[model samples]
Target chain A: MSVENLAISFGSNQVLKSVNLELHAGETLGVIGPNGAGKTVMLNIMTGILKPDGGRLVFLGRDILKEGVVERVRMGLGRTFQIPRSFRNMTAYENSLVGAVFGSGLTERAAGARARDILDMIGLSGKKLEPAGKLGLLDRKRLEIGVALATGPRALLLDEAAGGLTESEVAEILGIVRKVKESGVGVIWIEHVLQTMLHGTDRVMLLAEGRDVICGRPRDVMSSREVEEAYLGAGVGARTRRKRA
Target chain B: MGARTSGIRQIGGAPGPRGGWAARKPLVLAAAVVVLALLPLYASDYGISVGILIFLYMSLGQMWNLLAGYSGLVSLGQQAFVGIGGYTLAMVTQAYHMSIALSFFIAAGVSLAFALVISFPIFKMSGVYFTVGTWIVSEALLVFFRNWAFVKYDAGYNITVAYRISMPALYLGALAVGLGATALVYFILRSRMGLALMAIRDDESAAEARGVRLYRTKLACFLISSVYTGITGVVLYLNITYVKPGAAFGIDWTVCMVFIVVIGGLGTIEGPVIGAVIYVILRQYTYNFPGISMIMLGVAAVAIIMLAPEGIMGAVHGRFGFRLFSTERRPPPGTGPRQYPEDAADV
Candidate 1:
């Protein structure tokens, strides 16, 4: 999957002026950015939650810029929200069942099997009867990814899946992402946790001010002077200015 | 504890929501239908009248539940379809001198078409705006029908043929509609579309991301709901033998639907059944208090909503961990519960 020169704006606030990225099969492409860097916006456009003002999104040799969200999911592009959005009133099993039945258009019996497999995979088999609204944050986050995976997508877009987890919980999330990548599904992981991108990704892209500041091997990109000036350097300068003020 | 575990299995079984008495649901439903069908034969005239009210409100409340509880479309203008339905019966039977059989189909067709037409504007709004927008459309229609020469201006049209139909037959018709409405909700909730509808209700964008088509599913639900509401209206007007702009298109119908669904249960299948019974009994008793009746009903609705926000059925389900007419899909057998870390259960 590839996106080129994607852009969007609300009112006069230009969210994504122009952004580009590519994900090869079975690769984990980590996207790291500061607050309001258009990471979620880009994911939204790719998933068809929000339309890009101008861009090209090519998946499997087809320019799917015109496709809607459901059409995209059917075409094997699945996504999780930045703030986990599982169907709260439903059971954990039923949440996954929705994706298996509608996202993949499986028959009821087949969907039932698929949903069970997903819950087992996500380690929610015991809590299958529990309502999703009753699940803890870690479980809810796991269910978010589990629901997306139930669609049987070739590529998965995860938005801050480890946002509020503890160190061990974050490791568990990384383990699942590795398992997903090992299964030959391409991944675009947007994260604020620098360590995750450093160790978990095959490649890293730095997005600041709605533009790709750098993209390369994670370590190489992290060590670059441009990254320091745009990311850490800006942070230091802001703090020093605040101290003086 | 043992009972609770078995209850879990009953709901979680692969064939869906069956075990013990639940396994005999179909037989029970059939027997109830038989009894209701035979009701007018043994019941008095006043008893038959109350029975008709129960059936009609059940039909109306179920449709409202399907719209607000399942599809997440809270429409306050369902009265528009009801009014349209009653007037269609009047025009077909009285104005065109058509047979009663043809009028039922015409009323449904007209209501379905109106639903489609209003859906364009109303669907554009969401949440509270959609609610108000639907009420506005219904009010606009009320005004349109009042002045339109075709509907006899302010006077309204009467279904003269209603006099030709016997009370028992009308009761039978209401029985069919009430049973049909319940059956329709049951089957729809059990279908794959039912999952989609609940998903949409829970979260629209998430539902869409999971490949549930939003507009198409909503439109289908709206159309089905309107057709049933229209048919119920026909049965209602047939009973009264008179249709007027003020009464046929009044906000009273929407109030009854909302009251019944809210007081019984918002989304549960059994909610409307219980709600309709309570509503009918209250309405019948309140006739002696004429002026304060609407206020009394309002007070009753508020009290019920305050006590059981999910309605009586929801509160019952919470306390007992049981559901009848459930739309839940549980894991297959043999997938024993997995253990979670101790801290995970803290929340």
Candidate 2:
């Protein structure tokens, strides 16, 4: 999947301008920036939540800008929200079953089995029948990713999956992301946790003011002067630069 | 050890709290059906008429529940389809020379067509705007019917089908329609479409992201609801033996339906059934006190909203874990509370 020359504006404020990126199979790309850098908007456009003013989003060699959200999901693009919007009234198992049945085109029995497997994989097997509303925050985030995975996606966009978690919880999420990568599905993860992004991703992209400041290997991008000026401060950049030296 | 043993026994003896409730639901439903079927045989004429009224309201309440409660349409103009059904039945039976039984189907078709046409525009508005849009549509239909030439505008149309059919047959037909509509809703709720509807109800954007065709699913719900509401309208006017624009397209129909659904339970299958019975009985008792009946009903509705916003079934389900519909998932036998309590706190 690739986005070329993506642009979007909300009235007078332009959110994303000429944003370009390409995600290949089994690759994990980490996107980091200060708030209002259009990280979520980029993910939104890729997942067909927002229509760009000008751009080409090619998935499996077809322009999918006109496709609706459900059609895009069925076509192998899956996304998780930043706030973990699980169907609170439904059980975690039923939440995953929805993605499997409708998004993955599985039969009811097959969907049930798939949902069970996902809940188990997400480490929520014990609480599978619990209403999503009753789940703690970490479990809710896990269920969100599990629901996305149940869609049988070739690519996944995770928006801040580790935002409010502890260090160990962040490590757990990284492990899940690594496992997802090992399964040959491409992933674009937007995160504010710099350490998590730097350690978890194969490549990292830095965005500032709706534009890419740098995109390359995580260490190289972190040490670059442009990224230092745009996002990472001089102190952190110098420390990373000194460590690399 | 005693607690563990009792828990195991509970799981083994019944599925869960919800499961135990579900286990008896079918039997109860079957018994109710049998009782309703036998009512016309022994019931007095007045009793049968009241039964017909209850069944009619029950069906209308169910349709409104599906649209507003489950699908989140929140329409106040359901009387539009109701009016359409009555007018269509009148026209088909009198002008087209069709049988009264056949006119029911014709009215349904006409109402469905009307719903499909208007849904495109009405559904564009969300929440309160949609409610207002529906109300406006009903008012427009009422005005059109009032001015139209064929059915003798302002004077209204007298349904001649009432003369042909016996009161017993009419009561039986109303019962059948009520039962059929209720069953249709139950089966739909049990289907994939129903799952999609509930998901949409919870969160529309998230549901769409999970591959629910939002507009199409909601429109299908609107059309189905319109058909049933239309049929109820035909049954209602047939029993009354007259149809006027004021009564047919009146807001009172919508008010009663909303009250029945709210008092009974907004989204549950059995909510409308329980609600209709309570509403009908209350109406019957209060009909003798015309000035105070409306006041009493208003007070009851306000009490229900303030006390149990989720409706009676929702409150019952929350407190007693009763579930006749069995929509919730049953946890595996060994799964219960977490092993580490601190793990929950760390997150």
Report the number of the highest-DockQ candidate: 1
Candidate 2 structure quality by residue, lDDT tens digits, B1-347:
99999899887775765556577778988997899888988899989988998889899999999998888999999998888888888888877778877877888899888898888899899989999999999999899999998878988878876788898888988998788878889889878888888788788899889888888899999999999999888888788888889999999999999999998888888788878888998899889988999998888788987888888887887787666666664423333333221111111
The two-chain DockQ for each candidate, comma-separated, is 0.37, 0.27
Q: How would you encode candidate 2's per-residue C-alpha lDDT over A88-197 as one tens digit per residue?
A: 88889889888887888777675776677777777899888888989998999999998898888888999999989999999988887887787778999999887777
Which pairs of residues collide in model 1?
A126-B338
Estimated TM-score for each candidate = 0.90, 0.90
In candidate 2, position B179 carries an lDDT of 85
Roughly what TM-score does model 1 have, to 2 decimal places?
A: 0.90
Best by lDDT: 1
lDDT of 2 at B182: 86
Query: Model 2, which residues run further than 4 Å from truth?
Result: A223-228, A231-245, B1-21, B41-46, B329-347
lDDT of model 2, residue B134: 94
Question: Model 1: which docking level applies?
Answer: acceptable
